[model samples]
Target: MTLIKKEGPSQMDVVTATASVSDQDSTKDVSPATKDSHTSPADPTEAGLRLYDHGGMVLVPTPTSDPKDPLNLAVWHKCMIIFLVGSYSAFSVLGTSGLSAVYPSLIQAYPNESPARISDLLTYPTLFMGIGNLFSMPLCVTVGRRPVFLFSLLMLIVTGFWCAFSDSLGSHVAGRSFFSMAAGQSEALAPYIVEEVHFLHERSTKLSWFIGVQTVGTAAMFVATTYIVPSMGIKWWYLIITFVNVALLLLSYLFVVETKYERVEATDGAIVHLNFAEADDSRDSESGAVRNGLRLRPDIHGPRTWQHDLRLFHFKPVWSETFTFYKDTFKSLAIPSILWLLLLNGAFLGIYVYQASTFAQVLMSPPYLFKFAYLGWVQLVQILDCVLLVPVLGYGTDLLAKVMCRWRKGVFQPEYRLISMSIPGIAAVIGCVIYGQAAAHPTQWSWMGVVAPYHLGYFAFLGANLVSITYAIDSFPRKAGPVLLVICAGRGFISFGLSYSTVPLISKTGYDGAMNIFAIISGVLAGIAVPMYFLGTRFRLWAMQRLWPKLNQ
Candidate 1:
């Protein structure tokens, strides 16, 4: 904001500057969508005026007028899209950890392989899952959201069949790896949908749904497969999942609209000071309010039709843009805020991933000698955790962000959301400690004990992520586009790296010792948040000013 000397304007010039957007185009919406907002400023200083969105509050990723822009879509319509995406996200996790139910059978099936090696079936696929997430970004940008989603579902279907009939352990592992690769897109791509379609006011809540539904799906799959594998066998589990993919593919094709939008006019998301008047019915963010966007008038394009949604391909393939977007997807990893959030989310997810990968191995061995059929009961407890924590962690943080924003006079501070991290951060450490203690002293704690905390560890994992992701995006709304990729990809790569070590780590350190390590790490990470809450703003600002320009170009 370089200041310039200027001649004084007359009262007439002032009146002209303050005229409503309607003065220019009656047919257009109250808000003009362009790189430059033509609407009057929200605040007038002695020298000039400051502009804003959302009745003088700056809307993040400023709203646009294009009928197809997801931000401008009807509330119910956007909800339906998120609902479908959430469902897709939930089921996607089944491909990652669902096979935990059959770990014993896999051991026998792969007699020549070590138990540690067999764990590769679960561990290694996570790397491929990250790869899949990375792949989805460029495709979703270059191709279309619907095509990428439909294509990933296709991958799941094909790879699922490949896993079901695989005779050798190597083949089965490969199939699982590929199966997860397809499913992993839900982690990256779904969050992008949530970010693009929802407002800053509600973004956290939507992101929590992304986390919560997926966690529930993970637990649900474990429960179902444990029961299924015992009676119908492992192949049936694969077949059932395949059938699920087929149904999901069909549902997606019908309901998942292409979200790749090139605005007829641009509404860049940026905050600015402005003076504007609020109207009586402005509370209605939906419908014909410019707050969201004045809908296409009945005289204009009217409501979007089902025919538009059901269509698959929205754009021609642009290989050049694909490569560019592919690089852009990874660029956020360099931002200090992005890297911090990645570490935070990864730390929390690690506790859950480790628990998930190791649970069957621990319970089915000497101490309890539990049968595979009983693992479902363990997952049920995690399902309970999922149900209990979603409201507390997801919606809770969203409410906090809203309250804090109002306190700051609509100037949102992303750091305020980290207050939600306390409960989960504490829970993460406590859960690790208690779960570790139980694992070490099984004779005292018993098999009944370890699984409960082990299952519930996922609650802490997802809860922390819910806070980290929402805050990270809020901290840098301009870069929110890439937060999905960085956080999800980092989680994938981090979790994958942890896989090779989890089994051996427990073996060397003993159960309690391994958990002690995680407990300390989690506690340390949690402690870092206190400083982050204070300094995070500075770091993000510095990165945006110093680093963003270079990376973006």
Candidate 2:
């Protein structure tokens, strides 16, 4: 009756193990239909009784040893890591955009703050957020994922509280910087989740969900900022969010059991005897010793005590190893798959973050004269982005897959993901134009027309991200995280650059000029999507064959 029952591999075609692995050893073809006639209900525990498809021994959960019992599916064990990471990411995004909606009030509260000074609140956090990834990624690689996640969540909570209560500019800047440190995880954790929880087939949808949820978070903050900041007061809004963030911190600590499983590179039968307790103690001891250069003795640490960390750094081939990592990193930069991802996702990111933070400020103030709470309401536009755009694009992707599969006599092609980009690409350009034109002559259009860019633009924005991210994952199945990291890093840089300069650009050139230029860029980029759609599949194949091999050698 439980959601995740301990079903035997025979009953449900599932496999469980102490170390849930997906290597060649576990890939044996032994479905239920092929079960041997001689085999009865032998003790599955009787030294590795071949359990259905899984060649390795089944590590059954507590309560029963029956191989066919419905009590052990690893998929059902974890409560959807997608939702967990996505929810926490939502908190960080809310923190980032929340201040944008209420900047006027902040300025009024502290009248001496200049435009340059005000800009730092937005710019510095984003700047640090990008740089923070450099540290976060390495830390996750070294210290372990759970600790970083917990530490980041705590940072958000504590700093959010400080930001809420702090009055002075110095405290606000410091708090925002602390919050930025956590906010950077939004980029790093995407791959972390994608790498751990989701399978290759399901990665795109999960990544979309991650991004879509974060978008919703920003939109929700926009809604709340408009409503909460004015009614509850700016300080109270921060306090409320502080509590919410703190709750997330607790949730992470309590429920978020470590998913940072160390990847084993050894072949089957390559025994890694880890004395985890001893490994912990040895790691503690070697932490200081590795500062100079010396491996922790196995005698002192024991088998479980052997760690891959400090040894990685101390290894004589460290430079070559580092070069190899960076070489792999930069090679992805030139990859067409990566470039395509950069183009579509990067464009949307640039526009959305830029418009949401800057233009929302413009629309809500005098002439429009919308109050702070109502200003936050601008985020409602993104609701249309999510509700309307995501489903349509998602369905288009599914339909295209069916069509492509049918064309190939039921053989599916990864190119199916590209079809969804069509509507979003055009819509993005049109939306940008509309927003620019509306801003140019605000009196000419209704609020709907003025806000049309955001609502309509988000359709393409969300769709593009969905398509591109999915496509990237499909192309490089194993290296999806690294590819996504570059995509996210590029997006962050583009968005931050645009956001910092948006006010100045709009001020000097006017909204019409600024948005018109962006619109033109969108149009050109949208046009590129066509050739990309046509040749993208072939390009992926070529990349895998000629391109990747040559580079690897």
Candidate 3:
């Protein structure tokens, strides 16, 4: 069952294989039109149906005639969902780094506290954030996305207020930790949400927006807190974020809907059954309307009512699925490709955190006694790296994939995405070296000289992040949630550990020694992309044949 392009007025078409008599007999209570749609085909033994149209670039995820399927939703609806999720991710990262900008004030507020102890404000929250994924991932899989999102936002609001009002160091630590645990859902689940709603072509660009907003939010908060902390005091940071959280929470309640659906693949001439009865009836009524068109099915499932979407509880969690989540996570770690991605994502993030954690301490002392406000300006390099690099790499990689697909006669390999990583991989190494050298002799070089490497290194890091995750999703679309959860958890924990030890590590080794050591680690990890580009396809095929079968069992 192949997907051949038909020269119709519309560019898109649905190609479903005809169902068997047994299927129709089983669903006898279904409507006649639906029954006819599911009736047996002439040849019933055909396998390996085409699921995507490379010539027309259409998804073949077997979206029901139902408008409720995320793949079949209206453009406006898709954009709204994307915007809300992106905002949620941005705010999550913002909260993670909110305290970093005001460390000076935190130190003064608790005069007896050591620098490392104060840094716990950032460290503990980040650690809990990673741990949160274990619970959030399973809950999302069982209950649904909407409830998890609403609950997470509520927790953030409550915790943000707690942090704002708290005076004691212990209270602050507890509040931040709980707040991070809630916010961790955004990191673990947002990419999965993007995958649920968007198609293969749309995934990379939208994910870029999602992750780009996260980085921007982190950098922007530093800039905003610099001013807010000095005049309004450190407590105001939480108050501001709390207010923003509340507004976003309301928006989420109104706009976001459950995106979970079981999509089946059908080939040309196959009879596909519609999931929703209302959608089937509506499609049946539109006899003259062409089914094979670029337009999606109109919303026959009816209006997006608040009552329907606001359901707090849905499915019960099975303990077996929870066990599978853990088992799959550990089992995946053994795969060479998955292991490489874990290292790639974790090392870059750990190195980035190391730089961020120590940046203020190193710059605020000796030859470069940068004021708090000026310290915020130093993060502009990272902001620039994300803003400029994310779009280029995201859309560029997609374009590269399309070009390669065309060249290879419409056979798209996941390894094609890795080709774009070569430039960034080399850049990361160079950036790390320059950043290390500049830190060693701050007076010898200007501030720009010191920061240039950091920017370059991060640019490469961001690109690698986009490519690696997209590749993973492409390789294992069904297990995207667990795959991404593991990456987020691994990186988050690595970054947390590095953040915790940054002060002491630098104290012992000096700025040059710490930076160069991390640089070497990052260089080796990023350099792995070269071999991955050439051999990644073979690795993916090997895993699918050997590793996937046992894991599935």
lDDT of 3 by residue, 1-553 (tens): 2222222221112233322212222221222232222212222221112322322443434445444566655567667877778778777877877677677788888898787677788788778888888788877877777788888999999999998899888898899999999989876687778767775655678778777777777677768878988889868888998999899899888777788766444422222222221211112122222122222334554543567556665456566877777767886786677788878777777766766666676677678788878877777557787666666787888788878766654445667787877767777677666676777778786666566776676777677777878888876665666777778888888877777677788779877787778778877877787787766656654554565654222
Model 1 pairs whose backbones collide: 42-274, 42-275, 43-274, 43-275, 61-269, 62-269
Q: Candidates 2 and 3: which is better by lDDT?
A: 3
Q: What's the TM-score of each model vs. the native?
A: 0.83, 0.71, 0.83
Candidate 3 versus truth, CA RMSD in Å, comes to 8.0
In TM-score terms, candidate 3 sits at: 0.83
Q: How many pairs of residues collide in model 1?
A: 6
Q: Which residue pairs in candidate 3 collide?
A: 16-267, 16-270, 17-267, 17-269, 17-270, 17-271, 18-269, 18-270, 18-271, 19-271
C-alpha RMSD for every candidate: 6.4, 12.7, 8.0
In model 2, where do residues sit more than 4 Å from their true spots? 1-80, 138-144, 165-167, 191-196, 231-235, 257-325, 365-367, 537-553
Model 2: weakest 10-residue lDDT segment is: 273-282
RMSD of candidate 1 to the truth, in angstroms, is 6.4
- Please list the C-alpha lDDT of all candidates, in the order they appear: 0.67, 0.57, 0.67
Q: Write the per-residue lDDT of candidate 1 for residues 1-553, one digit (tens) a residue.
A: 1111122221101111111224332222233233233222132111111223344533444444445556666666666777767777776777667766677777777789998788788787778888887778777877877888888889889988998899888898888888888888877777777767776666777777666666667667878877787678778888988897788788778766776666323222233322234311122333444434232343364555687778788688888977666565566676666677788778777888877776766777777888777877777677677666667876787678666655544445677788888887788887788788877776677775677677557778777767776776666554554667788877889978886788789889987898889888888878787887777766664565455554322
